[model samples]
Target: MMLVFALMLCVPAFACLAMAMERHQETLFGALLSAAASRVLRCAGWSALFVALWLAVAGKGWALGLVWYSGCTSLGAGIVYGLLIVFAKRMSAR
Candidate 1:
């Protein structure tokens, strides 16, 4: 269950993190991520979502899987935001 949650969280976490990159500030909702970063995040998000689906198939039940996905994705978004802030500060200091 914990693993499932962690994997599910990877989706939005990467997506949001990519968007939070300094280079994206001028875009709408920071959607203008770099091509490489965008591709990587898109792949990661889809992979994580697929893994969650597999977990459901592996007897975790649809409800539990959905709940874990929701909770983890939300939590991951916040985590990514915090990480971006820390990294941005470090970069600026350099």
Candidate 2:
């Protein structure tokens, strides 16, 4: 259950991180984001990732929590990357 929570947080964190970049902003939003918006998203993404790590560490012991954190981050990043590819392909097809 705790691991699941961490994973959930990680997914959006990665999404925010992706959207913060110019390339991903174009791919996802169809236009460039303002510099301020990008900065905000970048900060929010890092903050969420830290919160997820804290949740994992607090819920489980350090050793187990760290292991689960690693897995969650990897899975979350992969999911976001896959979604980005799908969206890019769909946009190209249109």
Q: Which digits, one per residue and each the tens of the lDDT, describe model 1 over residues 1-94?
A: 6555566556564654456454644332424656686667667766765665566445445777677656666666667667767876776676
Best by lDDT: 2
Model 1 spans with C-alpha error above 4 angstroms: 1-37, 56-59
Positional deviation of residue 12's Cα in model 1 after best superposition, in angstroms:
8.9
lDDT of each: 0.60, 0.92
- Per-structure clash totals for the candidates: 0, 0
Q: Which residue window of length 10 is worst by lDDT in model 1?
A: 22-31
Candidate 1, number of clashes:
0
CA shift of 2, model 1, Å: 6.2
Error of 1 at 4 (Å): 4.6
Pairs of colliding residues, candidate 2 = none
